[model samples]
Target: MSAIDNLPPLREVIATHQLSARKSLGQNFLLDLNLTAKIARQAGDLAACDVLEIGPGPGGLTRGLLSEGARKVVAIEKDTRCIAALQDIAAAYPGRLQIINGDALEIDPLQHLTPPVRIAANLPYNVGTELLVRWLTPPDWPPFWQSLTLMFQREVAERIVAQPGGKAYGRLAILAQWRCEARIAMSLPPEAFTPPPKVSSAVVHLTALPEPRYPADAATLSRVVAAAFNQRRKMLRASLKGMAPDIEDRLIAAGIKPTDRAEQISLEGFCALARELRRP
Candidate 1:
């Protein structure tokens, strides 16, 4: 039995099932139950929340979520090889663990879960940022999940929580901080995973705000942010010239200098600019 639960240890389960992490799938199995539990705890008060987990290889973190009293855990895994192993975990918890064999990118998690939902996962490295951006930019405000506790490469994690004027800060920082409260919950070394990744990883926790911290049309804001940062070093006048015929006038009206670079603009500043561009 595993130290934390009645289920077998992750290593034993992997060996028994002959489950090997696949580079193509961006899999790096977390074999340490202690660390998994720590990641679970970072989600905060899972007893009342339904959690959506992506890429639960060998169910290590799945077990942690179950043991910590999550109301329900709906795990999405693309690898069919891991299903039977996850089934063992479902049997152990009975009615609490729901395993879905599918690609996370293609699946809509909200369709399967109720409100007061929280997403916690050691996300697949390849699609991690794409997933986060999807969650952040959903058409609707106050997204389905109450919060997100996700793991990412340390570099990616830094970008998620990065502030303006920092080297890591850019489009990601603006998007993440504009709509949610994002922070790095904890850091893990390269050695933390079963097959140590070349770079370290970190857990980022983001709580959704009731409304965007500043108001601007979501699509407009996204386009404006994307355009500005697409040429990070260019003055806004040069980069955003295609966005509007009178882009310089819009920048002036928004109380922004057309000569300013993307990295120098704050979230609210960007919102102001987007609002100006959005005007008829």
Candidate 2:
């Protein structure tokens, strides 16, 4: 069956399966087949990788990925009603789609997929940041997945690719930029999604670094970033007050201006500060 012919329109499938968007699950189904197809292409060549797609409500992106020549796709859907709809895609593709019914957070995509894995998803709004942080801060070096082609609220996307001293620059920017080469590939207005999310959305493509930009522990780095940005309105010396009395000294030692606000510092500067804090 052709990509268009094989899967029913997402709306019909959702209704037939009685799949209503559950707010608690962060569900906002993507109904436009053409839009999903465009997103699938953004992942580059899916023919070479096992695609990891999270929250594929109604399987719109799933169908697109399969049609785009995916070697295989492991779709993790938390909604049971959506699972049956995805089962149809699995049957249509035969061996190319595997629908796992659970949260993507609990399942490690790398363990389930081999090398050359790439995550392509119209992620659930709430967990998108959490999931991206997990991928960007994998405990092991030379992290899994060749790249990530994932969607986020436009504001969130700004945070991912936001530059030093930019208004959007903060913890997310630091963590994402520190470990990956990132760029915002495309943007979508609120109308792009079914039921239309209040905010616009954007797709971000992040390829992992060979190693993080600096020598530091991911956990410690995240903590330092979080503390510094939690009170971004203040200078680093004041914002990181809860961390230690020497926080100002450490910031200066790391070559970051002690008086600079969190948004003013670069990702490398954050890493350098984390290293300083990591020492006894």
Candidate 3:
């Protein structure tokens, strides 16, 4: 039986189904039910919340989400082999588990689900950053999910919660912190996966705020941050040269030093620049 959910052990299910990790799909199955349970618990209370799980390889984390009393789980997996495996999990939980057999990037879990949702995933490494940024830049506010509990390469996690003036801060740092409160919750080594990733991984917990730290459009902020960081070592005046002729004046208006590198400016500072960019 599964340690947390009393379902069949994942290994047995994998063996029975002849499932193996598929690298092209970025699959690294987390076979440890206990570890998955811990990741579920980190999403805070789940009693009444819905869950969005990406890449539910063998349904380990999916089971943990349901076992923790999530009202429903919307799992999206791209690999066809895992769909058969997840079908077993859906059967075990009855109506509470909903499986979408497709790439998560192609589906917006928010539109298909109700409020009080929290995204909890041991995400496939390749698409994790893209997915997180989408949530952070939701066109509308009071975002679909109440929280995000996601795993990423240890370096990526560091970048998410990194502070200005630190080596880890950059485009991701500004985008994440401008709108949500994020921090690293836990870390797992490469050995934890069925086919381990070369780099260690860590979990990041993010709770979205009612609004951003300052009034700045997410799209504009995304462009500004991405551009600034693309030439990070250069000062803002040199890096943000694409803007109007007086872009340095704009950065100065935003209260950011014209000489500051992208990594040297805080999230609020980036928002200020984004706001200034919106000006005519």
Candidate 4:
């Protein structure tokens, strides 16, 4: 039995189910029940929160969330081969676990979840960033979930919490930091996975703030950030010229120098410029 549950250890479960990590689906299963439980703890007080987990190969983290006292866990896995394995977990935990065999990108998890929801996943690498973007860019100020604790390549995790003036500081940093308190909560070596990925991984914990740190139209700010970082090497005056005819004046009015590059500008600077551009 695994340390966290009566179910067999993950390797045994994988062997019985004939499950192998599929590169096309970006699967790298984490097999250590103890480690998986540790990752779940980073989400903070899951006792009352319903959790949404993605790509739970062999149900390593699924068991973790349940054992860690999550009120309920709704797991979405695209791999049909792993359905039976996850079903084993559902049986073990009874109603505490819900397994959905579908592509996470296509399905809306909100229907299955109650409020006070938190998302925790050892996400499939192929769709991780896309999923994070979707969560961060919802139309409303306060999103459906209370928090997101997710695993990503170390490089990608750095991008989410990166400060201005670094190469990693780009659209993602602006988007996440504008309305959430983001930090890298844990790190794992490549060797931690069943079939280790070449790069290291880290878990990012983000708790949503009631409102954005600075007031700016979300669409306008997104456009401004995208344009600035799309050609990050170019000076603001050159890259953002397409945005407005007098873009240099707008930059100065926003308290930014015309020659400054995107990497040098803080999130507040971008929001300020976005407000200026929104002006008639």
lDDT (Cα atoms) of all candidates against the true structure: 0.93, 0.85, 0.88, 0.95
Candidate 2 error regions (>4 Å): 1-5, 242-244
Clash tally, candidates in order? 0, 0, 0, 0
Query: How does candidate 1 fare on TM-score?
Result: 0.98
User: In candidate 4, what are the lDDT values of residues 142-204, reduced to their tens digit?
Assistant: 999999999999999999999998999999999999999999999999999979999999999
Once fitted onto the true fold, the runs of candidate 4 whose alpha carbons sit more than 4 angstroms away are: none
Give the per-residue lDDT digits (tens) of candidate 2, residues 48-147: 8899999998889888898889999999988887878888889999988988889888886666786688899999998999998888877797877888
Candidate 3 lDDT, 208-248, residue by residue in tens = 98887888887888888888889988998999989768998
- lDDT score for residue 214 of model 4: 97
* Candidate with more favorable, higher lDDT: 2 or 3: 3
What order do you get sorting by lDDT, best first? 4, 1, 3, 2
Tell how far residue 179 is off in model 3, in angstroms.
Answer: 0.8
TM-score of each predicted structure versus truth: 0.98, 0.92, 0.95, 0.99
Clashing pairs in 3: none
> What lDDT tens digits, residue by residue, belong to model 1 across residues 1-280?
6678988889999999999999999999999998899899999999988999999989999999989999999999999999999999999898999999999999987778977899999999999999999999888888899999999999999999888887898888988999899999999998989789999999999999999999888888889999999998899999999999999999999989999998888899999998998898
Candidate 4 lDDT score at position 154: 100
> Ranking by TM-score, best first?
4, 1, 3, 2
Per-model C-alpha RMSD? 0.9, 2.0, 1.4, 0.6
